[model samples]
Target: MRFVPLSSRLLPGYGTLVLAITLVGIGVSITRPYLSLFGTDVVHMSAAELGLFMCVNGIGGILASTWLGRLSDLRVAKKYIMLVAAACSALGYGSFLVIHSYLPLLIVSTVLLGLGASAFPQLFAYARETASRVPDVDATFATSSLRSFFSLAWVIGPLLGSYLLQAYHFSGLFAATAFLFVAVLAIVFWRIERRPPAGILGSQPVKSFAVLQNRHVVTACVSYVAVYTASSMNGLYMPLFVTKALHGSDRMVGSVVALSAGLEIPIILGLGALSARLGKRPLLLFGSLCGALYYVGAWFAQRPWEMLALQLFCATFIAISVSIGMSYMQDFLPDAPGSATALYSNTNNLGQMLGSLLGGAIAQWAGYREVYLVCAVLAATSWLFLLRGKRFKAQEQKALRAALTSQDIETTQTRRAANGD
Candidate 1:
């Protein structure tokens, strides 16, 4: 099946998004993967303190992103908001070099890092709005392309991070992250055009609480939380499940990690192409089932090779949920791009946190295999939640039709005013 590639015509409006997201994605991948190691080895923190550090960072990210998400849809241009987010994230990452103490580090993660992380979702929000103007391109496809750039960055980010970490230590690594974010700022200032607030749909920004009142939004958020939580749990324990239970070596763990990431890049693009034809709900349900299928494979995996091959299902689940899921969430609240992305981001952050905590407990209390079983259950449950909400499409179509009618009226009014009507 042939697909429409990223056309050159779309680049002027969109090219910077690719570059900016790549830089930040690489920067994030470089430092975040090794953060726990830095905390333990550098700060000399106790186990509980380390846990506190991670928990606080996660919570801070949620609150900061959610609040900033709301503010972005208001009077100010989102590009300016994104500039601030990039600066804060840079400061937060750079601070890692100097602040070796736990309390001060906690403060930075809670504020700066939290605020900084909001930029990624804002980038998606910006993409959604911009893509809406470029009618020739499918918005979902544009978002998926951006998501692919981030995914591609992650594939290489770890190797580069390892080199930097080995050579210059955490100082060099964090310094690099800060520098990259600075590049993101330059890209935003120069490339991203200044636009008015999010009125592309001719709808005023609604209150955050009002958006959540929609049944589809709530249902989608909860369902995704389950999928993300399951994915998180699987990621946390997969290594142990291979090593401790299957008696596989670290090679298998590395193989699975690398393979899953490798497979995700293409699948993200492919499913994105299919989305315009197959519709999101079907693909979403299919992805959710993939998660369950992968976990079941992991549960029965006796050899490392068998586990390595199961990455197909794992990659499918991740691509659909991770990349396409954002667009799906936005469908529920087309007018509030910032809020829609923020709500999706919060579910992701919340799910990962829950997975880490719950996965650890399950592994300790039961076994590595049981963790997979529980996650399998969660994945299936998430699918059911989305499936039951089949009526969401009717409302979604009605909203889109209304939005189009409103836009046409506004255009005619603007033309009449220009003619001195």
Candidate 2:
């Protein structure tokens, strides 16, 4: 069969999923950057207290990714799960209007909205699995293309948040975010929930974590965790490096962030296509190496502008890892795209937890620059796991073939015995 382009294979309803993601991204970006500020400035909580509160959000993400992500794969409607997630997000964000204390902020941000944010990954899983039904579609590329919508959201969300902050303060920002999620829930519930695409029905219930049994999946999970952890560490400390280490202004930090976010959109969309051509492994390896090199270069930056320039490389690594990483995970666990992408996302949250703690400790003990060195080491370690996964692929394929052959033989013997009797 002739190869069908990923663009042509996308059905109409997939657009709804992408739009939902963009909305969610906007809602999240509006509040995410401000959450710490809100807690510290408005709620009268200390920075330390805010940090602990953020940790609860991370824990929520971890729990949701592991549990709810799999639930969508096990005899449940993914759209309904998505609906529940959105409602929770709305509830969490809206609560900010009434709840000003630290405890309420913690409960809303960490417990409710945090888990609700897991809908992001679930949406990806739904897209990947749904796209797989189309013959000749590059499901990974399609899904990654959808992923870029969030990057687009990142570009606009912060600016929108800033406007809300300047105009209406935290109350406006939270209300706008809550309303945005509610709007998405309404749109998706009407478009997809009322009329889901065909072939989205759940399969027989398998072991909820059965995908973990695959060695390739496990190794890929390790590599994903490492890559995300490094990225997370960079995210946490890069601003400090700009301000304290290199004496850059806040404007410079914002510019660097903007450049990276803007550049990542095209890079991610372009590389999603590239992965369809060169395959996911090479892309994954290349991305990981770039990440390692980018961090190592950060170790020697003498000026803020130099670090800003380095974001070019950082953008590349991020684009490849996020786009191809999902593709790679789905490749190993073809039968359960929801579970596969969920696990992939879980590693990211796990990485965030580890990276934040590790980076904070390193910064406290050594310095902000030392944190980059640690990130480089971790990125390199992840690359090693990627290599292991590559080498093991052949063995895994051979085992799969053997298992199929044995099952075939057993079926034949049973048929023959029945005929003879």
| Residue-wise C-alpha lDDT for candidate 1, range 347-395, written one tens digit per residue | 8878877776677567667887888898999999999988877645756
lDDT of 2 at 175: 94
Write the residue-wise lDDT of candidate 2 on 240-267 in tens digits.
6777789986446556666776778998
Per-structure clash totals for the candidates: 0, 0
Point out the worst 10-residue segment of candidate 1 by lDDT: 3-12
Angstrom error of the Cα, residue 119, model 1: value is 1.1
lDDT of each: 0.79, 0.75
Candidate 2 weakest ten by summed lDDT: 197-206
Q: Candidate 1 local accuracy as lDDT?
A: 0.79
